[model samples]
Target: MSAGLLATSPGGDVLVAAIVVPVIGILLLWLVRPRAVEWVALAALLANLGVAVAVLRTVSSSAAPVAYLIGGWQPPLGLALRADGIAAVFMAMAATVLVPVAIYARGAFGAPGERRPMVFWTMLLAITAALNLIFCGQDLFNLYVALELLTFAAVPLVSLDGSRETLKAALRYLVFALAGSVLYLLGVAIIYGAYGTLDLIGLASIRGPDGALLLAIGVMTAGLAAKTALFPLHLWLPPAHAGAPPAASAVLSALVVKGSFFIALRLWFDLLPPERAVAGSTLLGVFGAAAVIIGSAMALRQARLKLLVAYSTVAQLGYLFLVFPLGLGSGAAPFESTAWTAGALQLMAHAFAKAAMFMAAGLVYEAIGHDRIAEFRGLGRIAPLTVLTMTLASISLMGLPPSGGFSAKWLMLTAAFGEGAWWWVLVIAAGGLLAAGYVFRILVPAFTPPEEPIARVKPVVVRREAAALALAVIAILIGFLPLAPWPLLAIGRIAAGAP
Candidate 1:
């Protein structure tokens, strides 16, 4: 069978379902009673998860990219939805994280009546649809639309509670995201004028090291970096993520920013030539290293639990950019496979672990009435399960043994050594140590006894704690996989000669 039809030519149908099912849920939410919104959202997400799993299985088993020609026309003339290995992995990750976020949102947002549960559900579904669209988009223009959808969906999530502080944060996020959109659109225009095509594969076939291409790449990368909240451009992240509700924070930190970073990865590694990638890779890595240092330090200084986790996300994103340097360098030993897999694994691991941690922290805040980290003493007595979940999730974040974070770090370290990029190895190690410090900052106080009788603590829900623990366990379990390159990641990559 041809590659396009490998999934019984059902790939396109599944892709559309993945994107449309959530959108349909969003529309249905407005028509349905508010009390039923959560159930509908959950059902839609579960269905999306099944579709995502099916797509992953089909792509991995086929070991090729799955393409769905829209309106029965081929690329450059018509739009297409395509899922390669990376896209499949991200789709699955987003689906996995959304399930827990949806469950958590039930209590946090409240069901129906007065609090506008329908609006929350609608935004959640919209966010899911946008993320899936970004993952599957094969054309640059289509991706731009997906990104706009994501930003709009995500902005409301920040201020779901309608608080003044959260509204301010949402506004800041909107302004910065708009700036990024303008820059990205300008870059897309340049690319279209230069190459007469916006399809990634089509452009890759004819791209050259010219002023137009380089200028476009620089503008696009900067724009994506802004959207991703990478390092120096992270002015809006800490406040926006920290101010949102726990479920919203988890999705924002864990998956939303990653949608843009994934595109940046594609722009450099898949679209640009090896020679062009070298200098650009180093520049990106330098920014990544700085983010690791600066973000980790900022995380350590945060007084609030949610704010600390939010800043940690800023640091973790830096690790993703390191892939540019480690994977694209020509002088590097042939460790591209390991670097690619490691970067991807880091993305997945961080998503699961961070989401769990944020949810767990939210539970803690609900129990304690506030999220001040220093005042978390005696929390273990009140909510052992939630605290335990936080600890487990932190283990992964700190890159300790038997957690996905450790596996990702080990592979990245190996790739760095193979390439003689000792500086990156040191940066990775430093980031881990800083992560340990910040994680322990919370763990120690939560586990320790209070100086006096604990004040009235809110009741902890068993189901909520279980939901958070499940995600943390999944993150830790991924570490047990063999410590080597992951073949699943390489499936469906564009062939060297393919357009």
Candidate 2:
């Protein structure tokens, strides 16, 4: 991307507000009665959505980055916040998934004043704030802080129920995260020592494929891959996500994992020079392909419903890594390429579909008191709404027509073939077929009639059901985006020196 394309612009304060609004709520939560937290958090998220939309409108209209130089100082001296078209899109994604999860949680967690409910609400809003910063942050160190905030907030929600088992899962999650943090910090130290500044744009200005720089990239990528759970490093995710309450699980699967993945994107596509990126990108794609094949098989082996969804996440996240290789194949600038747009659509589609699926799984747990797939017979009849939600969400995951997943896969397939990357095409097709197999594993048995009237494990909340369904609908609706290389994705992307 051209250095001339990015600069501080009007509506910069909106970028500040996008991060500060939820931090204000986090602070005020202690002063308010616990019951008021939900109302306050919900209102804040709604307001944040409005601000995010305005930022999106501003960037779209200007066709450039909306940037803020913190304290009137530029990089190497002060921090920055910037929203490109991609950032705006992700901010919108966070709001869409989060507000609905908030609504669903009101019923899932019961009375608001309770400690668990209060904690969950505060953390949920905190996650919204942290993820926003992750998307918009321009300083590497500043982004690290936001990532830690996301990690800490997310860890608590994993063990929200306070079960001994959940506590253990949370502990395991924390330990792995802390280990990843150490590696990430080490990489940060290396970069700072080598370059004397940690701003992304600054690094981009001076980046080269030196040994020091490559070492930093290697260590940092390892750390991030751990957090994003791209493959073998995913040991902690299934337990943590599966154990959390439904709403929390939705946020974790849908948005939290994407936070680290987003930073990885920044590193490879935005910060790293092309010559340096190719080898690393291909390595990531290899890991991704491995994840899709192995993770899907693991998912098929799961007997429980939520575990299947969790392992499927392991597979779905792998698809994102394939972008690195696909983007590199055609000598096309990655930021402006079909592969880039395809990957971004995949990210958004999975967010909506996975959130809905996790929530629906939670409801299934609520309806059946057990997530064992064997006992799931007749659930479609007993909780038609939840089952319907799962089915629709699955359609997106399976990459079927009239859904965003299909659109993403279709574009990626085109890119693969255009680049003559037939190997990747096979991986994509195999991954989709495996995805269908796992999805059917759940849905087919769900169509069976139970031996007797299914017992309701808990009271059914119509609003809760609706919230999950809304996310599923959003996934389907994203398929409506034009099925071609998207110029919208390039609205604020810097690719050439003023073309």
Candidate 3:
């Protein structure tokens, strides 16, 4: 290892802590009595948030990728951990979404005496650990482990209610996810055989556009697309996401699927040569556009509130894939980097807004005893605060002005115009319109006066409503950020000679 690389700093240590601390908390919860688990989980999440903020400060000040070679061993011999601008941003986003979910779940999951609450907290921690690992992992094999951990952690959450329908959904998700793992593993094996190393930085230097490499990229991407629930491959997503508890649904839809998508982005842009990416990128984008149309249509037809939100997730994921064609055009331009950041910002904004929406939806269901959309005719009259939060979140989803969704759409539109890809621009506009329609479908009914005064089944806690509202407000506030490419996302570009 070079002397420059070995100069360890506090920033690097915090990167390790962001992942390790949550796992430690999970261990403590298992070891301790059930009564203490929720408090322990909340404390760990708060501490993890502090560490994430520290990491952001360190990276922003240094303006360099923070690297930590585990156990003092260098790459190829031992695992390495790294956080560049993108990783830090995502880590912070995850922490921000998680804290509120933790708070909301305290009421939804109930006291630690029940087995369900304990299991929910434990799985939440495991999911947190898995996501941190995915973001920070520098080795391909290590990332595979993290991906599997994420799957196992997330699958249980879908069936946490122990209902037959939820159980069926969990099984379907498990089967498809396992198949994805197989394909991804096969790609990893090919890469290992061809390049003799699975480290991302190491392979970036040696990988090329050969048949083996292309095949590996194709198989791996196909696998990840399934996990990401892109288009025709998204059959399992609606049921799984809608069946899970609201907190779990928020985490699953907002962040869990994103983990695989992040890996696919790294594989295409960082690992593969530019020329080889054209066909695959177009194919992915086609599916994405289809998802936007199909998922939104399905969402409009859904009867239940949570199901509608789940289908909306399917539609939203499609926009992420559109980045491939718009960002990396036939010829490069100065705005390419801007497009990349726009896509990332979209992911971040969606995470916050969707999580808030789902949590708010959950609170509504709790108050009304059911989630039937038609039956919620007077929801605003009963739980005005929760309804207000949902309205704010829907504005972001509909890409209204002064919201994060608007900022993301603006950048994506700019990229489309710059690249002469008018189709994507049309897609973005149509998606916004469709989003507005579906959001209004729900809100219109909620605002209408009921023939008879709707009786509230239960009273909602202010703190839970406040937590959901705070997240929605953050999503709206992100729009105020300057509409330019973020430098942090460009800090650790996968150059030809980095490894």
User: What is the Å distance of residue 112 in model 2 from its true position?
Assistant: 2.7
Residue pairs in candidate 1 whose N, alpha carbon or C atoms collide under 3 angstroms: none
How far does residue 39 in candidate 3 sit from its true spot (Å)? Answer: 0.7
In order, the Cα lDDT scores of the candidates are: 0.86, 0.87, 0.87
Runs with alpha carbons beyond 4 Å of true place in candidate 2: 1-7, 494-499
- Give all TM-scores, in the order shown: 0.96, 0.97, 0.97
lDDT of 3 by residue, 1-499 (tens): 2321332455698878988999999999888787788889999999888988887888888977788889988778788888877888888899889999999888577667687988899899999999989988888889899999999999999999999999999999999898887889999999999988888877777666689989998999889988999999999999999999999999999999999998888888778777777777878888999998888889999999999999999998999998887666646632236678788888988998999999999999989999999898989999999999899899888889898989998998988887788998888899988989888988998899888999899999999999999989998998998898887777766652343
Candidate 1 wrongly placed segments (more than 4 Å): 1-10, 330-336
Predictions ranked by lDDT, top down? 2, 3, 1
- Per-prediction CA RMSD (Å): 2.1, 1.7, 2.0
At residue 437, candidate 1 shows an lDDT of 92
Per-residue lDDT of model 1, residues 1-499, tens digit only: 2222222255567888888899898887777876777888999999989989988988888876677877777778888888987899889989998998888778566647555566677888998999999998989999999999999989998988888999999999999898998899999999999999898877777787788988998999999999999889998999999988888888998899998998888888767777767888898999999999899999999999999999999999999999989888635322236888889889999999999999998899889899999898898888999998999899999999999999999999988998889999999999999999999999999899988857746898888899899899999998998898877776655434444
Count of residue pairs whose backbone atoms collide, per candidate: 0, 1, 0
| Candidate 1 all-Cα RMSD | 2.1
